[model samples]
Each structure stands twice: as structure tokens, then as C-alpha cells.
Target: MTKTGTRNRINAGAWLISPPAFFAVALLAVPLAAVVLISFWTQTGIRDFDTALTTANYREALSDPLYLQLMMRSVWVSAAVTLVTVVLAFPIAYYVSFHVSPRRKPLWIFLITIPFWTSYLIRVFLWKVILGYSGVLNTGLQWLGIIDDPLTVILYNVNAVVITLAHAYAPFAILPIFVALEKIDRPLLEAARDLGEGVVQTFRRVTLPLAMPGVIAASLIVFIPTVGDYITPRLVGGPGGLMIANMIQTQFLRLNNAPMGAALAVQAMGIVAVLALVFVLVLRKLTRRLAQ
Candidate 1:
């Protein structure tokens, strides 16, 4: 094509995307910028903020013992949730991709998404009920004569938080892995088999490598949001299960310190960003090694 034609095509493509691009900038970038900007400000009084730039909020957010503990706890819980969700999701996704009939694949996917039919709060609340002292699990265990007392250990704790978040994010992890698995060439498995590789070896060498992209995507999707999750931890987490997001919420609402909250939020985001980048890089390197 001529240079003018190429330019026109580029201009047309730009025009087509301009509206959504502007929308993204307005809704996403603008709010993010505002948060980062507010993180540097100081709170002077109740419902009062000083526009002067300072790092006191960041300093306290990073240095304070409580905040540091909360940050560490959030990371730990998020990691556990990511690990559980992906491990559980992969088998389901793999089964659907490799075992289920193509015609029934859509139905399986639909079933996987059935959790989305309910409100997220409702789901968390339901888990709270199931894990409660006298809840379904304890009652069932008691009826079966397995336990004498309703277990108090499962509800309103870090274990409860991990369980709830893992279940909540399971579908997010499944679909990406399903898509990635679907894209794998069946002949590669056959070729591996023909080359004297066992089923497990074929999978370890061929299937998992190609599916790493989706696994990586699912991990990030689950990890990023779970790290910042407030509702699940608030409803089911109790005191011990509360995460950095809970602290941030307290700063913003209960303590009336938006600047501190914003600083904490920024730091949480930075930690998640670093972890995600490292995860992707490490996974990619491992994937390459597995492929070879």
C-alpha cells in the first residue's frame, strides 16, 4: 500500500479506538492518578485534607508495625488463595478441554460460572454460614459422629478467608486455563505418545508448557483482586483474617484519614505489581525450560 493509504488506515484505526481510549483514560487512569496524588497529601482534620505534598503517609504505612503486619498477611492470604484456586481450577479446565465432548463444553463452562449468578456478598455470607460454629459443616460432622463440638477454628479466621477467596476466584482461574488448553494441538499429545513418552510425561512436557500463559493470567487475575479484597475478609475474616485492605478501609472511613489510606493502597498496589511481574517472569522461564 501507498504511504498515504497506510497513514489513512492508521488514522482510521486510531479514530475507531479513540472513544474507548478516552473512556479508559477518564475512568481508569484519572482515578489511579488521583489516588497516587492523594497518597502524597496530608490530612489536617476531620473531613479536611492538605494539598501540600509529603511522604508521612507512605512512611507510616511502610514503617508502622501494624501496617507492616497487615501487608504481610494480605500477601500471604492472597498467595494461598491464588495457589489453591489455580490448582483446583486447572484439573477442571483440563478435564473439560480434553475429556468433555466439544458440544458439551459450553454447558460445562456455563456450570462453572453459576457462582456469578449470585451477588458476591451473598456468596461470602453463605460461606460464613457454612463455616460458622454451628454451621452446615460442623452440624454434618456432628450428625456423622465425627466431632463432639462445633469447630470454632474454621470460621472468622485466616483459614476462612483463604477458603472463601479461593472459591470466589476459582472460576476466574478456570476459564483462562480452559481457553489455553483448548488452543493446544491434539497432535502434539499424540506425537509425544509416539515418541515413547508416558501420559504424565507428555503432559508435563507438552500440555503444561503451552497452558502456562493462561495459568499465569489466572494467577494474576486471582492474586491482584484478592490482595485488595475487603468484603470477603470483612465478612468472613474476623480480626485475625483482616488484610491490608481492611486497614486501608479503616483509615479512609473509620479514622477519616484518606491520605493514609491512599498511601497504604499505593504501597499494596506496588507490592502486588512487583510480585506479579516476578511471577510472570519466573513462570515464563520455567515454561521455556519445560518446553525444551
Candidate 2:
């Protein structure tokens, strides 16, 4: 196209994108700016707070050993959820993508998303019922004579949080991997086979490499929000399962420390950002090495 035509098209594109851009800025950027600003203010009492700027919130959060441990545990739990969810999701996505008929793919995808129709809170509570001491799992095990008594290890801990989060986020992981798998050139695998590469070898060198983007995306989807998840940790996590989000909630609600809560939120965001950045860099390097 001519320069004038191209410029006009560019202008039109910008106009089309402007609405979502403005919405994002108004909703996300503005609220985030407010949060950062509030994090520096001083909380004077339960109902009263001052606009006086201070770094004491950050100092206090970083200095506290309990907060530090909770942050670390949150990161660890998120990582575990990402890992387990992706691993479970990959096979299902692969099956649906490669084995299912194209005409039926939509049905399979619809089934995968059926869980989303329910309230997330309800789903977490459902997990509590399923994993509770006298819940479905324990009852079933006892009926089968697999256990002499109801297992106390099933709920109210980090393990329960991880299991519930993994199940909750499984759909998020599957869709991305399915999309990535769908984009793979079938001829690449045929070429590998013709060159005498075994099934496992072809998958390792061809399929897995090409699909890394989706896997990374799936991991990020599970990890980022799971790190901030307070409800699951609150409902089923109990004492040892408590994460950074729970601590942040305690500050805002129970402790009545809004400034400190805001500070904790900011620190959590920073930690998540740093973790995402490191994952991207490491994945990029790995992709390059594999390419070479």
C-alpha cells in the first residue's frame, strides 16, 4: 500500500484499539497507582489513617520473619500448582488435539470449561467437603477397607491447597497447550519419523520444543493468580497452608493495617513480577539452546 493509505490504516487500527486501551488504563493502571500511593501512607488507628508518607510499612513487612516465610511458601505452592496442573493438562490437551475428531473438539473443550460455570468460592468449598476428615475421600477409603480410620492428612494443609488449586486451574493449562499443539506442523513429525527418529525422540526434539510457549503460558496462568489466592488457603489451607495472601488479608481485615496491607500487596506483586521475568529469561535461553 502507498504511504498515505498505510498511515490511514494505522490511524484506523489505533482508533479501534483505543477503547480497550482506555479501559485498561482506567481500571488497572489507575487502581495500581492508587495502591502504590496508599502503601506509603500511615495508618493511625482502626478507623483513622494519615496521608503522611512513610517507608515503615515496607520495612516492617520485610523485617518480619513470619511474613518472609509466608511469602516463600506462597511462591512454593504456586510453583507446585503450576507444575502439577501443566503435567496433568498436557496429556488431556494432546489427546483432544490429536486423537479427537475436529467435529467433536468443541464438545471436548466445552466439557473442560464446564467447571467454570460454578462460583469459584463454591468450588473451593466443594473441595473442603470432598477432602474433609469425614468427607468423600476418607469415607470411600474406609468403605473399601483401604484405611482403618478416616485419614486426617487429607485436608487443612498445604497439600490440600495444592490439590485444589491444581484442579481449579487445570482448564487454564489445557487450553493453551491445546492451542500450541494444534499449531504444530504435522509434517515435522512425519519428517522426523522418515529420518528414523523414534516416537519418543520425535516428541522430545520436535513436539515439546515447538510447544514450549504454551507450556510457559500455562505455567504463568496457574502461578501468577495462585500466588495471590487467599480464598483457597483460607477455606482449606488451615494453619500450615496459609500463604502470603492470607497474611495480606490478616493485615487489611483482622489487624486493621491498611497501609501495611497495601505494602504487602505491593511486595507480593514485585515478587511475582520478578519470578515471571526470571521464568521468561530462562525459557528464552532454553529455547535458544534447544534450537542450536
List model 2 lDDT by residue over 1-292, tens digit each.
Answer: 9999999999999999999999999999999999899899998887888998999999998999999999999999999999999999999999998899999999999999999999999999999999999999999999999999888776999999999999999999999999999999999999999999898888887888888899899989999999999999999999999999998899898999888999999999999999999998898788667645
lDDT, model 2, position 251: 88
Q: What is candidate 1's CA lDDT for residue 276?
A: 94
Off by over 4 Å in 1: none
Best by lDDT: 1
TM-score of the candidate numbered 2? 0.95
Q: Write the per-residue lDDT of candidate 1 for residues 73-105, one digit (tens) a residue.
A: 999999999999999999999999999999999
What C-alpha lDDT do the candidate models reach, one value each? 0.95, 0.94
Error of 1 at 276 (Å): 0.3
TM-scores of the candidates in the order shown: 0.98, 0.95
